[model samples]
Target: MQDQPLDASDFELIEDTLLKYGDDHSVLNASELDGYFTALVSSPVQVDIAEWFPAIWGGQNPDWQSPDEGKQFIELSVRHINALATQLAMHAQAFKPRFEQTEHHAQPLTLAEEWCFGYLRGVAVGNWPELPTPLAAQLQAIAFCAEQDNFEPPADLDVAQHRQQIEAIEAAAHALHDHWVAQR
Candidate 1:
């Protein structure tokens, strides 16, 4: 049987725990973690958990109040990662990125920056090699979101434009996963 998927409560617990223990450098929320796992799952090569787990804490493991707490966190993380992999492989186009939405300049915008940053971090862990032109274009779509420092939205930036960019991120993720699946 397929492993049980994480529920809303599980995500709430994750969010709570992250807020309680995560530092400035650590992944601040479940959405970012989801993006991180998405990239890890879509990577051309398998990235070992040993190498990637600590990355969630920005290269240091979190100090849990109890061992059981840590166990629960690890279990949930593994389940999430597995679920993302399965979704990407079996329902590539149906995959939707876990992005947080917030208002910027009084206009609603999808905050993909954190998610994209997590994805880029995962890509770094995988030490991704040069890609073909087509795949590069897809990855570029994601990278554009991550380049927060270089991006400055104009005063007239429409919410539709932001939505379109977020949609491209989803498509890129699905395409990247499909490419790796075909390769493997």
Candidate 2:
């Protein structure tokens, strides 16, 4: 498990594996999966991949013919999250959150919505205590992301506006991580 950034190939592999063996899990997209991982690692309460994996897989056992490959995936995922968490904790300003795709896609907002939903679910699954004011505000913003479903971008929100919203979400993520780290 190296502290390497997950590249596009890694995302493709993860998405393909989830499609094959996630037992119809909702986190099929890279953004949602990344968000879930980030939340798990940044959570105030401890969470293990062993428990989280089953939950993400919809409580169904992974149907991996090669268990070693599954293990590798889990290890890589944990390492990836650890790297992100470290970056967030050490250099918050330098931290650039990775979304699902690079170029503009048709489902950017929808993907963002799913990512927020996954992130919130991760927080809920943890043994989280009462959140601080900043963290709570961040949660509220993420909740707003979860509620968005319109395919058409709002007239007021152009591409730049949408990107700003995502930047805010990324900032909130870093803020939540900082809050939890300070608690420690």
Candidate 3:
């Protein structure tokens, strides 16, 4: 799909999750909530990866082979993040025309983009192949935030609350993707 997708209730869950955690200091304190948080933060991505993957570069992070190794890792991560941001923007912008639905619709995400991101999440993490670790990790966050659900929205949920929840999740996914782009 070319746009974001979601049922009413899926939106509610996402929003609640975000609203639950958005204000949490931990969410903003760290670049990521998963792997590489501790290890990579202290070292460059390449050095960290090589150190972690001894066969690749032979204990590089601890005793680097070159003075430029750390810089190289930073540059590489930056490139990767930049590229991911462009790709994300392409997909997100691709939704604007389609998701607007009404001339005055505000910050709406389309069903297509949601499906695209969800599908992307599956491909990135679902044992399809060995993909880049950082990208996969970030996609997991997006999936967690924007994930669609099959259940119905609760009976007690008001329409405005549902819409706000959807917007919140969509915003979170977008922000997390932006964080990925910004991290390196």
Model 1 C-alpha lDDT per residue in residues 49-68, reported as the tens digit of each score: 89999988889998789999
lDDT ranking of the models:
1, 2, 3
Off by over 4 Å in 3: 1-87, 90-148
lDDT of 3 at 111: 32
> Least accurate stretch of 10 residues (summed lDDT) in model 1?
149-158
lDDT (tens digit, per residue) of candidate 3 on 1-184: 2122433453344334324433322211111211112112211122323333321122232254455654543343344333333445566542211111211134332232333333333232222343367655645544553354233344453656545654544454454445444544
Measured by lDDT, the strongest candidate is: 1
Candidate 2 backbone collisions, by pair: none
TM-score, predicted candidate 1 vs. hidden true structure: 0.88
TM-score of candidate 2 against the unseen true structure: 0.82
Show where candidate 2 strays beyond 4 Å. 101-111, 149-157
Judged by TM-score relative to the true structure, which candidate is superior, 2 or 3?
2
Model 2 local distance difference test score: 0.71
**lDDT of candidates 1 onward, in order:** 0.83, 0.71, 0.35
